[model samples]
Target: MNWIILVIAGLFEVAFTSCLGKAKTTTGNEAYWWYAAFALTCGTSMFLLIKSTETLPLGTAYAVWTGIGAVGTVLMGIFFFHDPATFWRMFFIATLIMSIVGLKLVSAH
Candidate 1:
């Protein structure tokens, strides 16, 4: 059950961050909606994630949340918004993945 909440929190984290990025691109009424979605999703997700990480390992939960957010944002930038496909940037993302994995391993020990 906590895992389920954590997953929802992760999704909300992605959605909110993505919406915030989109909000920057949007203008007028749509921008307002995007901003609201971003705020709401982030706020709600953070609350749930805090509750979740209490039961889960702190390092494990945080690493997962941040990993999801970072990866999701970059993927959105590339596939959805046509950001440049730079090898260096992708390579750094791989670094982030490795760091997250390392964090999880450390926490398990």
Candidate 2:
């Protein structure tokens, strides 16, 4: 299903972002490896997004994709990157999750 593909693409987006974060924190060959992973995952995410968009409404699909990426990246930041998990930040993330669900429910696919 296109939705599944879209979700996978979004996950790849998360992975690419995580790779970027790792790259930022490291040095030399380790950083280069993370950057390489970032490129690979980013390309895969884009490819999957394009494939899903063939059957999905562009606006809805893009919003959902970015929403998934944003939520996932934020969670990764909190859990792995030692970013702050303030109440308001968590509240907004929850709202983003709800909005993503709402979009899926209303989609005509």
Candidate 3:
């Protein structure tokens, strides 16, 4: 369904962002490879987002998509990029999750 597609798109957004992080840590050919992955994932994410918008409300879809990407990228940062996982950061992430769920529940589709 469109929701699934939207979720995939969001994940791809995460992937692209992660690729950027990876690219930052590398050099020469490896950095180029990561950048290539970034481009591919970014394009795929956009395409899926456009497809999902056909059936999903643009506001809801965009919010959910960015929400997923934000949460996912933060987690990726904590796990992979050594980002600080402070208490306040986790609390806000949880709140963001709640907000995303709230949007889904209130949505008509």
Candidate 4:
């Protein structure tokens, strides 16, 4: 159940980031609404992430949460926002994933 919460929090992280991307693009009243949505998602997801850390080790939780969020954000932007994921970008992202996996393993012990 705790892990479930963590996953949900991570999903929210993605939501907030996507909203942030959108918020940065528009201007006037529309941007205000996007900013509001971004803030709400960020606040709510952060609270859930804190709750998640209650059961998981802090280091492990933080590392996984942030790593997953970063990678997921980039991948999502590529797919949804049409950001370029060239060969170099893919290589770097892959490296990040591997390093994060190592961090998780270390933190598990």
TM-score of each: 0.78, 0.99, 0.98, 0.82
In TM-score terms, candidate 2 sits at 0.99
- Model 3 off-target regions past 4 Å? none
Name the better of 1 and 3 by TM-score. Answer: 3
Candidate 1 ranges beyond 4 A from true positions: 102-109
Model 4 RMSD vs true structure = 2.2
Question: Best candidate per TM-score, number?
Answer: 2
Query: What does the lDDT read for residue 78 in candidate 1?
Result: 91
What is candidate 4's lDDT per residue for 45-103, written digit by digit as tens? 89989998887887777777787788889999999899999999999899988977786
User: What's the lDDT for all of these models?
Assistant: 0.82, 0.98, 0.97, 0.84
Q: Tens digits of per-residue lDDT for model 3 on 1-109?
A: 9999999999999999999999999999999999999999999999999999999999999999999999999999999889999999999999999999998889888
Model 4 stretches astray by more than 4 angstroms: 98-109
Error of 4 at 104 (Å): 5.7
Candidate number of the best lDDT: 2
Q: Write the per-residue lDDT of candidate 2 for residues 1-109, one digit (tens) a residue.
A: 9999999999999999999999999999999999999999999999999999998999999999999999999999999999999999999999999999999999999
Q: How far in Å is the alpha carbon of 16 misplaced in model 2?
A: 0.4
Please state the error at residue 62 of candidate 1 in Å: 2.0
Q: How far is candidate 3 from the true structure (C-alpha RMSD, Å)?
A: 0.5
Q: On a 0 to 100 scale, what is the lDDT of residue 52 in model 4?
A: 86
Total backbone collisions, model 4: 0
Judge candidate 1 at residue 34 and give its lDDT: 98
